[model samples]
Target: MSKMTGAQAVLECLKREGVDVVFGLPGGVLLPLYDAIYQSDIRHILVRHEQGAAHMADGYARATGKVGVCIATSGPGATNLVTGIANAYMDSVPMVAITGQVNTWLIGKDAFQEADITGITLPITKHNYLLRSATDITRVFREAFYIASTGRPGPVLIDLPRDVTVDEVEFSWPEVELSGYHPSVKPHEMQIKKAARALMDSSRPVIYVGGGVRYAGAHRELFELATKINAPVTTTLMGIGCFPEDHPLSLGMLGMHGTKYANYAIQESDLIVAIGARFDDRVTGKISSFAPRAKIVHIDVDPAEVGKNVRVDIPVVGDAKNALHGLLKEVSPKARSEWNEKTETWKKDYPLRYIPDMNVIKPQFVIEKLCEIAPDAIITTEVGQNQMWAAQFFVHKDPSKFISSGGLGTMGYGFPAAIGAKMGRPECDVIDVAGDGSFLMNSQELATAVVNDIPVKVAVLNNGCLGMVRQWQELFFEKRYSATILGRTSPDFVKLAEAYGAVGLRATKPSEVEPVIRAALATDRPVVMDFIVSPAEKVSPMVPAGATLSEILELEWCDVAQSCHLEKIYAEGRKEVLGQEEF
Candidate 1:
C-alpha cells in the first residue's frame, strides 16, 4: 500500500469516487487540506461564505443526481453550515460535508476555532463521524458517501481533526462494511400486490407524488403509474417537477399554498396512492381530517417515513423506482370517467389566479412570462412568496428542473444554489427566483458567481417587505406590520449587482417584465433582474395554519367567486404543447 498524508488520501478517495468539483472556504485548520487541494486536479469553488458552500453542494446534487461535496473550517465555519445541512436533510438531498476540527490533543480544551460539529449536527445528518486517526480517512469517506447516497438520500458529515490531515498513513481502498445499514432495494411482492388492489378497487383515487420520485429518478415510472390508474395527481412542494404540470391530470401542487383543486381532490378521494411521499404538515394540513375518507397506500425508500405522518393502509418500504416498477407490472389500465369529470371541473373552477393590476408587475405574471420565454432554464427559489409564486405560476415540464429549500426553508438558498446548479449543468441556463428579504441573506455570493465566471441569472421579486410574513400579518395579525417591512432598509439591487461586477436590470412596470428577463438572459455574465412588484399581492388558495384542506381561503377567489377565472386560451395552449385535444 502507498503511504500518504490523510489529506492526500481524502483527495485520492474523492478522485476514485468520481467527484470533480467541490464548493468550500479555507480556514486555519484546513490549511493542510487547501495545500493538498492546490496540488490536486479536483476543482474547488471559492464561496464567499461557508453556508453558500453547503447550499451550492446541495443544488449540485439535486441537478446532477450525484453526491455533492462541501468543506469548511472548525467553529464558526462549521456552524454556518448548520442551516444548509438541515435544509438538505429535510429535503433529502445527497451531500457530504467535510469540516476541519481542532488538533486531536486540543479537542477538549476548547481551543480557538474548535467545535464539536458531529454532536451539533447529530439530529440533522443521516450519519456523521469524528476521525480518530489518519488511517480511518479512506474508510470514513467511503462510508460517508455510501450513507449519504443510499436509502433516502441525505447529508452526511465527516469531522477531520487537523492532526489527522497532516499525519502520514498507509493507503488502501478498504471494503465498505456497514452490516446494519442495508437499504431495501426490492419491496415485498405481497405489499406491492396489496397496494395494486387498493389502487384498482377505488373509483376515486389520487396519486400523491413526492420528492422521493425525483430522488429515485422515477419520473417515467410515476408518469406510467398516474396514466395507468387514471388518477388526478398532486405533488408536494418537494415533489414539484416529478410529474408534468401541463398534463391534464396534474393538480399543480398541494399543501398550504397548493392548488385548491388538489386540496379538494384529497378531501374527496376514496384512495390515495402516495408514491415516495412523507405526509408532512405542509402537505397535509390538520392531519385528523387529511384524506379522512381515503385509505393511504404509502411507498417510500425509508421505512420510518411510511406511516410517520399519516396512517398507511398499505406500506411498501423500498426504492421508489423499484416499487413503482413493481406497481406498473401488477396494475392494468382502468377508466374512472365520472371521477375524471369531477377532477376536471375542480381544476377549471378553482384555477390559480391573481387580480392583475397593469400599473405594477405581479410576481405570478413574471413567473408565467419566465416560463414562456426561458422554457429550458433550470429554476432555484428562495423561501416565501417568490417560491410559492414560482411554484404556482411556472409550468415545469422536466424532472430535476425545480430546486428549492423545501423542509428547512432557508431564506438564502436560491442564489448560491443557482451557481451550484449552473456548475453541475453548464449547458443549461440556471435562474434563481428570489424575494428581496431572502436575496439579501446571501447576496454577497454575487461576487462568487462573477469571479468564478458562473453566469447564473437571478430574478428578484422585490416587494420591499418580508412578503410571507406580511401576508400572515395581514390575515392573522390584524396588519400590525411591526418588523415585516424591508423597504426602509432594502438595498438597491441594481447597484448591488453592479458592485459585484455583474449585470443589473430592473422592471418597474408590467410592460418591462418580459424585456428585462430577456435582456438578463441575453447577457453572458451574471445578471440580476429586480422586478419592483406590489406589496399587496398574496399567494392565494392558502390553507390557513392548522386548518383542513376544506377550510382553504382564496384571496382573489372571493373576488372572482361567482365565475371560473380560467381562460380558454390557456387550455388551448396546454393542448398544443401536449399534442392531444382529448383528456
Candidate 2:
C-alpha cells in the first residue's frame, strides 16, 4: 500500500470509478486537490465560475447518460454550485460534486472560508459525505458515484477538509459492495402487468415522457413502445427531444405553454402512460384537474414520485428503459384508429399557428426559420417563454437534440449548457435560444464560447420584459406588472457581444430576421442576435393552478391587450381559427 494524501485518494477513487473528466474552478481550500489533479490522468475543465462548472457537469451527464463529476472549493465556491446542483437534482441527472472544506480543526469555529456545504446541500442532493478519515475516502467516493448514477439519479456531494487532503493514507481502492445501498430497479411483476394492462385497455392513450427517460437511457425503448402502440407521444420540458419531435407520432410537448394539439390530447386522453416523469406542477398545472378522466400508469425510478403530485392507477418502480422492455413483452399490440383519427382531426383543426406580420418579427416565426436553416442543430434554451417557444416551434428529429434546464428552471442555464453541448458534439451546430432577461444571467460566458472557438449561436428573444412571469401576472394577477417590464434603458446587447470579441446583430424587422440568422450561422465565431419581438405576445392554452386542463385559457393577441388594458392593436390583421372538439 502506497502512502497518499486525501486529495490523491479522491483522485484515485475517481479514476477507479471510470471518471475521465472533471468540471470545476480552483480555490484556496482546494489547492492541494488541484496539485493532485496536476499529476493525475483526469482532464479538468476550468469554468469561468463554480456555477458554470456544475452546469457543465450536468450537461455532460444528461448528454452522455453517465455520472458527471464537478469540483469546487468550500464556502462561496460551494454556494455558487448550489443552483446547478439543484438543477441536476430536479432533473434527475446523475452527478458527483466534490468540494474542499476548511481544515478539520476549524469545523464549527466559523473559520475563514468555512461553511457547512454538506448541510446546505442536503435537501438538493441524493446523499452527502464528509470525509473525516482518510481511509474512508475510497469507500465514500465509491458510494457517492454509485448513489449518483443509480435508481432515481441525482447529484451527490463529498466535502473534504483541507487538512484531510494533506494527511497521509495507504492508497487502496475498495470495490463497491454495499448491499443496503443497492437501489432497486426491478419493478414488481404485478405492477408491471397492471401498467401493461392499462395501456392495452385504453382506446385513446398517449405517452407522456419526462427527463427520467433520458436519465434511464430509455429513449430507444420509448420510441419502440410508441411505434408498437401506434400512440402519439408528448414530452414535458425536461423530456424535450426524448422522442423525435419530427416523428409523426411525436406530439411535441404538453402543458401550459405546450402545443395546442398536445395540450388538448392530454386533456382528452382516456389513458396516460407516464414514464420517468414526475407530474411537475408546471407540466400538470391544477394537479387535481389534470388528466381528469384518464387512468395514469406512472413508471419512475423513484417510488416517492409515484403519487406525490398526481394519483396513479398503476405505479411501477424501475428504471424507465427496463420497465418499458418488460411491459412491451407482456402487452399485445392493439389498434386505436379512432384515437389516432381524433388526434389527427385535432392536429389539422387547431394547428399551432403564428401570424407573421411584415411589421415586427414574431418569435415563433424566427424559431421556425431557425428550424428551416439548421434542421439538425442542437438547440438549448433558457427558462421561461423562450424555452417553451423553442419546444413548440423547433422541429427536433433526434433524441437528446434539445437541452434545457427543466426542473431547476434556472435562467442562466442556456449559454453555459450550450457551451457544454458544443464541446460534447463539436461537429453539430449548437444554439442557445434565450430571452432577454434570462440571457443576461450568463451572457458573460460568451467569452468562453469565443475563446474556445465554440461557434454557438445565441438567439435572444428581446421582448424587453420578463416574458413568462409577465404573462402569468397579466392572466391571473389582474395585470399587476411589478418589476416585469424590461424598459428600453437596458444594456446594449450588441456592444456587450462586441466586448466579448463576438459578432452581434440586432434584428428589429421581419425582413431582416432570416438574413441576420444566416449571417450568425455563417460566422465561425460566437454570434449573438437580438431579435426584437412583440412584448405584448402571450403563450397560450394556459391552465392555471387548481384548474382543469380542459379549462385552458387560450391566449390571443386580444387577450394580451385586454388583460393588460393596452389601447394598441396588439395583433392587428392576425387571423384566428376556431378549435375543434375531439377525444
Using TM-score as the measure, which candidate wins? 1
Expressed as tens digits, the lDDT of each residue in 1-583 for candidate 1 is 8899999999999998899999999999999999999999999999999999999999999999999999999999999999989999999999999999999999999899988999999999999999989989999999999999998999999999999999999998988999989998789999999999998899899999899999999999899988987888899888899999999999989989999999999999999989888998988999999989998899998999987988889999889899999999999899767989998999999889887767768888999999999988999999999999999899987769999999899999999999999999999999999999999999999999999999999999987778899888878998676777666225889999999999999998999999999998888999999998766688898999899997899785232221111223224445565686443
lDDT for residue 156 in candidate 2, whole number 0-100: 97
* TM agreement with the true structure for every prediction: 0.95, 0.92
- Report the error of model 1 at residue 90, Å: 0.5
Best by lDDT: 1
Which residue window of length 10 is worst by lDDT in model 2? 569-578
Q: Give the Å shift of residue 355 in candidate 2.
A: 1.5
Which regions in candidate 1 have their CA more than 4 angstroms from the true location? 557-583
- Please list the C-alpha lDDT of all candidates, in the order they appear: 0.90, 0.83
Cα lDDT for residue 555, candidate 2 = 69
Candidate 1 weakest lDDT stretch, 10 residues: 559-568
Query: Residue 38 of candidate 2: its Cα lDDT?
Result: 99
